[model samples]
Target: VVGAGPAGMTAAYYAALKGHAVTVFDMMEKQGGIARYGIPEYRLPKVKLDKELNSVWQLRDTEFKGGKMLGRDFSIDDLFTQGYDAVFLGLGAWRSNELRVPGEDLPGVIEAINYLRMNSEGNPVPVGKGQKVVVIGGGFTTFDCARTSRRLGADVTVVYRRSRKEMGAHYSEVDDAEHEGIRLEFFAAPVRFVEKNGRVGGVEFQRMALGEPDASGRRRPVPVEGSNFVIECDTAIPAIGQVPNLDFFEREQGVRKTKRETVITNGALMTDRPGVFAGGDVQMGARTVIECVAQGKLAAKAIDRYLAGDDMARVAEEIAEEEAVPELIDIVPYKPEEPQVRMPMLPFKERDLSFQLIENGYDKNAAEKEAARCLQCVCPDVGRCHLQRLSLEHGLTDNRFHRAEPVDYHDYEYDFSHDFILRDLNKCINCTQCVRICRDVIGANCYGLMGGGYDSIVTTPWNVSLKYTDCVSCGACAETCPTGALMMRERDLQTYELDIVRCIYCGDCVEVCPHGALGETPNFELSTYGRFGRTVLAKEELAVARTWKPSEEIPLDGHNSPRPPEIRPPGPPRWGD
Candidate 1:
């Protein structure tokens, strides 16, 4: 592995897991490349980063050689000669783009990447403490510099050529910088540096107007005629995008690279040379940390397959299919309104010269509450739901007792009534949270175990509508439900248009209503009335509901709350050993 960024570490991890002898070499002194040096301390602390990187160090037979750069210390052929089986190049995009404007070579004018890197180390750059700094560009790096300057007691201003919406930086970062008294001037592109006495004074900017969409699909910023302006300051920092630095890549090695300097690779991440693979920002230009990690992992797979003599093309196709965009399932889940748990941050008043971390990540309770609010749209409880997690942990992906026929899977209709809860029986994994919470916590005893064997399920007594039971509408059951089985409905009545053709006007719904949702109105008609909710009952549905007679075992103890019968397990698996 080369360049110990997120991608390199991830590749090293996967390679180590496969029992491969791995050695990570980086030009930097530390394991985390950008995550350690590039990002500011206030954003990502050194201790936390070190802790994460230490995991790779714990692996047996894996070695880390800091300051061992490619092309200088050793070449691709050199590694191959050293008995190494495979090489993964995770050289990240480190080299920041130059402004290419006049006076850019001035002393005070700096690149934000270098500034952040210097600050991250004990060595601080001289652009703070009574200095008026104007940062050019609007990206994470730009905000980082502006905010860092603010903390360093610099009167900072961020100038971008497009609207705030068009900025490449996250809105949260931009908002935080603005809140920290960092001025933001939009529709202004850096024209040149306003030199004063040779060193630097301020930056001259050109006012811009948005034009047709560029290749990126965002409106391109066009320079406005005669709209020249200058912001007087002591320093000018350009925090534009970065590109991969291939200074170490020798042409004699035969690895191809794009004009952007990103390494060109096949679908399997292999370069032109055999056994030479590249991934992360070095391959996919400048991307997110997660994307880099993903690239590293995929590259590891390709390397493993290559080593195992598998067809590279077939492996690439399978990987592409696995990583294909997931089909969008248009399933809307109802959830109660709850504000996100806010993470505590360092007070703005105390954010001067101190590199103390800003965000104090969510606590246990805060994390749990925030996690519980997830709609669990995909598998409902992907991260938070213990059932889903445990299923994955136990490797439940391939069930032991596979359904032999199409009739094995149960399909049940949904119940959207009861005002406060939604019941989608299809998603219920039978975790029994609802059964426990309703019976033990709420004491409403609305639900009980019904059916037998593999078909066992929790439902209201006799599978009656939740409103028919003594439900308090406290939403305890929905809250306790692990999956998207029972979700708390949005606090609104679902309007059901009355089909007059299907209405028999039998008034059975009005008679059997528990919440008094149906009753005589001022008009003295059998239409849906009262405040509980308006449910326009179809004559056919009413007929089926009317036929649902009370079982002899059911008792009228406030509700037809029938106690569940003793579960008698029928024998072991019929076919399994």
Candidate 2:
């Protein structure tokens, strides 16, 4: 097996599990391909990654060798000659895309991927302090480049050719840049770089406007004439996009190439050459990790079929059955909850010259609370939870009614910072769908379960408010909320109300309210004329009503007097006389 990324690793695991002797080769020192180097440790920590890597390494029949570059060290023919049954090419895309501008050859211009790789590998390069750095791109790499430059003591800024909403970077990442004082210039594209002393000293940019939708269905950025501007900077980083590296396959024997320089394969993932296959980034370009894993598994099964000399159709069906599992419950159609983690940062004065890790990881209790919010998208515990089903089967209603006391309404706080996803501690059932999505799917470990026993809850680092944590507003949490606790704020506004009863002494409401409006008291009393037309008496109105009484006699000429047309009864007076 070639490569050791998610797909390659998963393929090796499954192949070994099926009692096949597998040997995997990678160019890097570690097994986790892009995941180990491309992502930051703060997001996907080394510990968690180690756990996964170890599981794969423990496969008795699988072997992994690092520092082995294909084509350069050993060709595909060499592997076949070495008595290996077959070869699977999973080499990922590593070459970074260039800006292709005039001054891009200058000393200060660097590829964003290369820069990130160097940083991730702990390699020291020239990113001088007190220098101005500009990053061009709208993807996550651009943000990473900008933020990393900031840590290196450079005044960092991001220049994107599109609007903020169109940016490919995750929202939380963009928000982190903003929160960390990283300046962003939107609707701008790099025209050229200005060089001095054979090094980049500044950059010239062209203002761009959104044009008609292109083939990709996204509005293409078109340069506006006569809108060129220049900004002086010490360095410039290009993070436009990436493509597959097919140099190994191109030079290898009996390998067919596609028009796009990708590997050509038949129905069994076998190249035109027998016993040779390719998958993952080398086959699909730079895609998501999940896609890579899926490709790896498919390639493994195809290799097995080739070795067994079985019919491809039957083999494919068996592989599909192994991959597919039946769902016990159908979940309600819900959007993912927007992430609410926000990390408070150091003061501006402190940030100007520090390289400290800005956002801390979640603590034990905070991790649990945040994990509990996960929607657990593919889990079987959605509408037909075994606990709830069993309870109903036993005719249990209000199972703990005797022990249930009135919960302090004021103790429960609400977080509505993101357009989607609401956070209310009162309604959480402690299911961990949100946590799983954030960690496994989104590739952002922003949520986790924390604390012990009854004190436990899902939260971010330091038990901070979701609006102040490192959450990226992915909506995975709100999507998994079984109860109405965590919901999209935009979908339901009436759910937020200041109840007059059951308020405890806790001040959670004051702390968790992202908007101050929730805590502000208006002078207007609950009248039947407002939007909802529901009268809610204030504390003062209730007090006044308790002391009021009706008078014994009716007024004749006052506002409460009867009209003159109404005559009083004189018979009662005559009978009394």
Candidate 3:
């Protein structure tokens, strides 16, 4: 077994579990390759990584050796001669793509992968006296580089050849960078790097315009002649892309390559040579860590089949079936009414000079609240309510189970400020359905997790209310709310009514009420009104009623009386106040 990334590690674990004498080798000292190096600690913490790596370490018959470059230390022939029945090449793409420009070799120029790896390892690069830094690319790497520079006391700017909408990075990541004061210049292409005295100085760029849709369906960027401009900066980080290092395969053992220069593999990921297989970034190009894991597992199964001398045709069919099936859970049609739990962020000022983690992970309470918002898509309970089913199954009329610590509902003022839906923090259950729908489906970063712990609650940048935020009022959040918490405020009529009198202290109303309007109260005077017309009152109305009283009047008996009649002002309306 070779490589130590998620894919390689997973493959090694399974191979060992299956009783194969596995020996893993990697160039890095640690087991987690790109994940440990490329990703930021706040995004994928080392502790979580250690837990995963430790799981791999527990596999029997597995031996891990780090800091061993495959071709340099041993060749494919050496593995076959060592009595290993099969060899798996899981070497991942660790090389950074070059800009191929004039000043790319300047002293201050850097690659995204190296920068992230260094910083994640607590050995950050030194930025010279000048405060300006520029990043060129349009993906997650670009944002990571820019954000890292911002945290290192640089006034960072991102230069992309495409428009903001065309950015390939997660919208939330881009928004986070912007929130930290990272400037962006879109419709721009870097022409050449500007350097002085053997040091980086600035970048010359040309204005670009969107052209007709290319073969990829995206509008291609066309450089406008005579529109070149230069921006001065201390450093430039190019994060255009990354590719697999194929030198080991080529030099150590003559393995064939695809037209794109990746290793050529067979139906089961076996290279052109026998008893050798490859997978992960080296096979699928640079992709998500999850994808790498899936590939590694596939390679392991293939390796097992080869070792057992099973028919390759049968393995191909199985692999096809596995690839055809979707990985996401089939959730029921239930809407998620919970508000998104906010991820805590570092202050902008401090962000300029500190590499401190930005987002704080959710606590247990916050995790449970956020998890409750899941729609459980494709499950039988999709449209039907699971909480209701669970309550019925357990014969629970009241919430006798542990209650989550209460959040300060009043911190965020209810802004009837939007047309489609109302945002009332008091009613939100910390479900992230709205955030998911907006990001995954709509590709908009309008909403995101903010704050931390109990204080954490989803919000837009600058803490702008939904109306003032970039919300297009698409109603997706309302559509997926399991409880009526985030329902469309403009619905012709409110279909549900709260019967606080018969509520029996059951939180069904609270848990299912997405709007946060129906809340817990110490005063259950809802019993005062007749059972048929119990009403739900807004906090404001309740506050006003507390201060109301009848004006002074004389009694018909003769003397003025201080006491009022026992008759109560007719109880509140049935629907709501």
Candidate 4:
């Protein structure tokens, strides 16, 4: 791994997981590349970022070497000669694109990436208090520059050549910027930077009109003749775009670059060289952190295969197959609509000359409520569906029986009344696997063939809900059904009681859960009898109780005789009656 940004770190982490000795190198003194140096602290805190990067280093056979430039410090051949089998370059686009207009080289004309990097390194540029800052372009970096300047008590104006709809920055960022007293000027292209005493004093722009759609599918900005205008300012920051700095290697290195200055790679993320690979912003240009992480994962898989002496071309084909998106069927699952959870942010009034964190994040209740809105339409047994596997094995296609009259086939209403199980009778083939398993094997006897003749179907007694039957929620019926007529609900519906005695306190469950439902109480140390003698962990018992027993007496044998009743956690209401 050549760059320690999101992509490089992710690649190193996955590569280390494969039992390979991985070494991650970055040009900066720190591990996180752009995420640490280019992005402002308000957006992503350095402490949290460092914690994640440190975990990657903790992985087996992995080490991070900072202040090491790839092409400058060591070449691909150098790595190979040093006993390394393969190399991955997750380099970033640190070079900011410039505006071609004259006077752009003035003293106060700052590059957005350079400014952000400087601020991150604690040597912020002289952009504070009573200065007018003109930010050119409309992207995430552009807004970052504008917002950072705003926080520094400077009057910031974002100048974009295109209209609002074509602006690259997210709408939320733009809205927040506007709320923080930043001005926005659209459909204006920079003509020249106005100089004042050998420094940038203002910017001259020409009015533009939206023309036909360009290759990017957005209407191009066409310059309107003689419509020149000037916006007075003390600083000029052009955040037009970013491109990778490929000066480290020449063309003979077998790693090719495009005209846009991004690295060129095959489907397997390998360069022309057999053992060299590139990914992230170095290959895809400036993109989201998630996209960079995805590419890093792909590069790790390809590098593993390369090191294992597998065919590179075959690996590329396999990667392409895995990446291919499957066509979705035309079935829409029924799901109730819920409003999105609103993020809390610092008030605009308190933002003056302050870089304090914005977007306070969701609380435990809000996060769970938001997560519960997932439709979960994708069947859990999709790839493992017995019916699907059999159909493919026999090369089956359309059902010829569907060509018969509408009365020949039955369409039954789905039964989702059960708390833990979902029943879609329309998908049932009357296989009786559920009936036999329920009656003969598990002995739940919850299902049977109901109705008569053509109307006969496999269901609970008298077509009642599974909950009303002798169903034990053993999941044997769902496991035995070949078709998707029966299935276990994928969501974690029930609130669970943590057995303090059995819990190892690894905190893995708390860390890995997407929804913030589970939380650690402050006094888990009192859970064991070793801390305080007489099994005095009253909180665990009272956690689930409907009424408190102030006068309850302990058995003193440490077992407590009877356990406390299980109670559901507060908020994000449960589904079952």
Candidate 5:
């Protein structure tokens, strides 16, 4: 693993989980690349960051080596020579983009990343109390610069060429920065820095107008003629964007990079070099922390496959198929709507001279309430479902044959009649697995493909309930079901007592037995035979078992008589064995 940022650390952590030895290297003396250095302490405390990063290091066979610059200390070839099977490049984009304007090289014009890194390390830039600072650009890093300067008692102003909606930073970040008294000037682009005695003094700007949408789908910024202005300030910081510094990657390595300086990778995140992979900012440019973490996990999976002697091309194709967005299912579960929980924030007065944390997150009660609102969309048999796996493997998503008329569609009623099994005929693909398993294996012959043409469906005879059939509650049908058309019902185990008296002799009790455990007294022992390798009725309980004549009228007091206990069923080899 290279560059121990969120992506690198995540890859190393996953690799270690696979029982592979992983060594994480970073240029910084500490781990957590930009997460630790480029983010302000108030936003993410160093202590908490260290605690989280330490978890990756604690994994078995995982090692962390800091202060190892890629090109300066060691090259990619050096790693292969060291006997490492695969190398993952999670190097983050750290070099900030240039303003390309005159006087940008002035002393007061600080790099946003550098300023944040220095401040986080306890050495803030020279923006003293009551000084004026102008922040150029609109992004999370731009806001960080403006807000951090505000904490230092500087009169800060943020200039952006785009409107608020097009800004890269979240609305909450902008709102908090405004609440902290930072000024915002939109629809303005900086032209040059105003010199003040050989140091930065102010920035000249040109008013802009939204033009035609660009490749990013945002309106391009067009300079307005005769709309130039100047914002007086003592310092200027531009946080437009960042690109990966590829100086570490030698040209002889055969690793390709885009014009933007991001490494080029295939669908599996593998670079041109067979054994090398790149992800996160280095491959996809700067992205959110969560996105970087996801890429890291994917890279780790690819690396594992590569180490296992899998063909890279086939692995790449599989990854591309897995990453394809599947057409959305129309199943909409009804859930009551609830208002979102509002985050508590520190008062603006408290933020005047301090870099205290904002957004206190959710309290325990609020957290639980928010979590309860989640409509979990995961299927119960998600990982085990063969149909789902095949759907993904074949990319069988969107159904173009969806009929427009409601009469053309068929929706079946779900059958919950069986106590131990749930039958959703709607989910049946007519695979006949349940039919064959029941007839050939269990010999119950409870299911068959019924009807003709498109209306045909696999179901019990006469489309009756499963309990009404000759099912033995063996669960072989559900086990063999590729889709969740048939499934074992989940329930808590409970003790059941069958009264020896009140002998109506209607046989209704035996008829409703979900597991088919209740039957003629002579064959009753067989139902519980393989289930837990025990008998449903103990010797003491069976001694009292007796049949009453139909003419006998039992006393009401006989209702308290002990009966057969509810036994755990469908044991080894199959349910109900």
Candidate 6:
């Protein structure tokens, strides 16, 4: 892999996972590409980023060589000769696009990427305190330059030809920059840098208006007639965008690139040149980090297939099959609305003149809460479900209960009312474990055996939803179910408890529990003494209450005495009579 950006790192990880000898090389001293150097510390902290990247190093037979230039250190031909089977080119875009106006070559005109890179590396250039800095462009890089300059105590101003609504940068980031004291000027394009004594003193801009949609499907900016203006600034930074730096290699170097300078690849992520693969910003022409990661993953699979001498056609089909999005059913699961966790940050006053890393990542509690809200997007007890396992074991290809006539079978709607539990009537086997557990163990008597014999089923009382029941959403009934009838869904932080013996829904003491608040832990335990004075309550008893207890007076000579009274608490609230 060439370049250690998100794509390169992902490709290396997946390729190495498939038992391949992988080597990643980059020209920078650090492994991460733009994420480490181009992005500001406030957005992505290096420590967390490094911890993730360190995993790539831990992979067996995977090597990362920092400060190794592609053409200078070794060419593609050299890699083949060096006995490597294949090569991946994730060379990210490094060169900033030129502003192309007159006086742009003057001193104090900074290229956005290089300026941000320098600042990220702790090497301050011309920008400093009391300097009036004007940045050109309206994207992530533009805001990075403007905000970074503002952090350095420079009176920073951003000029964009398009409206703020049409900006390439995320709206939150643009708003953040505004909140950080960076001035914004829209509908203006840079004309030229105003020079004083051969150094930049200000910038001249032309007013623009929205024109017809361009090739990018966005409204093109048209220059307004005679609407030129000037803003005085000590420094000028043009952050238009960046393209892949392909200076070392030529057009006829076997690999091919589009007119926009992005490498054109086959469906399998392979360049025109055999055994050489390209992905990330170099191939996609400066896209988001997530997009780069997907391309990287795709390229890794393609490279693996190519190395194994598999047919490219089959490989393309398999790649497409994997990448194809699964068709979602129209029934959207109604998940409770929860606000996203806001990342903590330093106050605006503290941010000035200090790059002391901004975003304080989520602590354990915050992370757990945030993670519990994942919708799971999947069933928690999928593999371990005894019902699913038994069905597979018995070769249950078709449901014998699903009758041809609609009236022959009851199609009861799903009960998603309970916050942390999902009740699917189709999967219920009428074992009465949920009814018994809810009444006996949890005391949240939310369920009962309902209806006549032929049409009988277990559900919330009066068949009128669980919201009206005494269910606390403790997930005890769910944890006790023998099948997928009652499933404990994800619920962060909001938890309930149960005891063993009477809680026959589960044969074990501790269950994985719902998603959010906590994992299923034995918060409710009943300690009992055996014949030899050993606490023998075990895992199965962990889920139930003691149905049979020892007598108050201990009979020493192994006499199996009469059973003690069943200690029962008041049952869960009653909704119906």
Q: Which candidate achieves the best lDDT against the true structure? A: 5
TM-score of each: 0.65, 0.59, 0.62, 0.68, 0.67, 0.66
In angstroms, the error of model 4 at 328 is 4.6
**Per-residue lDDT for 92-187 in model 6, tens only?**
999899988999999989898989899889896788899899999899998888988988889999999999999999998898888889999999
Highest TM-score: which candidate? 4
lDDT of 4 by residue, 90-143 (tens): 998899998888999999999999999988899968788998999999999999
Q: Candidate 2 residues 1-577, lDDT tens each?
A: 8888887887887665445788999998888888777765545666688788776665456688999988777888888889999888888777778777788989988887788788778898467688899999988778877877887788888999989999998897898788777899999988899988889989999999999988878799999999999988888889887776776565776888876667877656678787888888778777777899889877877887788887665665655544453554444455445565545544545544454445566766666667666665432235545455556668876645323454522255676665666678666656665666556544455678887565567766676667665455546566555665566554524366666554431233443332233452555343211223323455355344334333433324334544231122222212122
Sort the candidates on TM-score, descending order: 4, 5, 6, 1, 3, 2
Worst 10 residues of 1 by lDDT: 565-574
Q: What is the lDDT of candidate 5?
A: 0.81
lDDT string, candidate 1, 1-577, tens digits: 9889999998987676555679999998889988887888888888999888776665546799998888788888788889998889999988899989998999898888788888887796887688899998888888988998888889999999999998899998998888788999999988888879988898888999999999999999999999998899998889898999997676437798888999988888988887888999999988888899988988887998889889887877766654453543433446777888999888877777777898988877787888888765644434345444456669987666646777887778899987778998888777786876566544567898899888888888999988777777756677556677888875524375767666645454554343355685544333222123334444444334434333534323224555322111233212221
The regions of model 6 sitting more than 4 angstroms off are 251-253, 362-369, 379-577
Per-residue lDDT of 244-313 in model 3, one digit per residue for the tens?
8776555656567765547777768888787888888888788888998988877887998899899776
- Write the residue-wise lDDT of candidate 5 on 1-577 in tens digits: 9899989988987676555789998998899988988888778888889888876765456788989988888888999999999999999999999999999999899999888888877885888789999999999999989999999999999999999999999999999899999999999999999998989989999999999999999999999999999999998999998899997566437798888999999999999998999999899898888899999988988998999999999999877765564644543446877888887888898988787777678877887788777765434444345466676669987764547788978888888989999988878889886786577545578999888777888988988899987787767678667677888886645466756443334344564444445676753432212243333444344334333332456323235653332322222223331
Candidate 4 wrongly placed segments (more than 4 Å): 328-331, 375-577
Pairs with backbone N, CA or C atoms under 3 Å apart (clashes), candidate 5? 570-575, 570-576
Model 5 scores worst on lDDT over the 10 consecutive residues at 568-577
Q: After superposition, how far is residue 5 of candidate 1 from its true place, in Å?
A: 0.7
What local lDDT does model 1 show for residue 217? Answer: 97
Question: Which residue runs does candidate 1 get wrong by more than 4 Å?
Answer: 248-252, 328-340, 374-577
User: Cα lDDT for residue 252, model 1?
Assistant: 33
Q: Model 4 clash tally?
A: 0
How close to the true structure is residue 550 of candidate 6, measured as C-alpha lDDT?
46
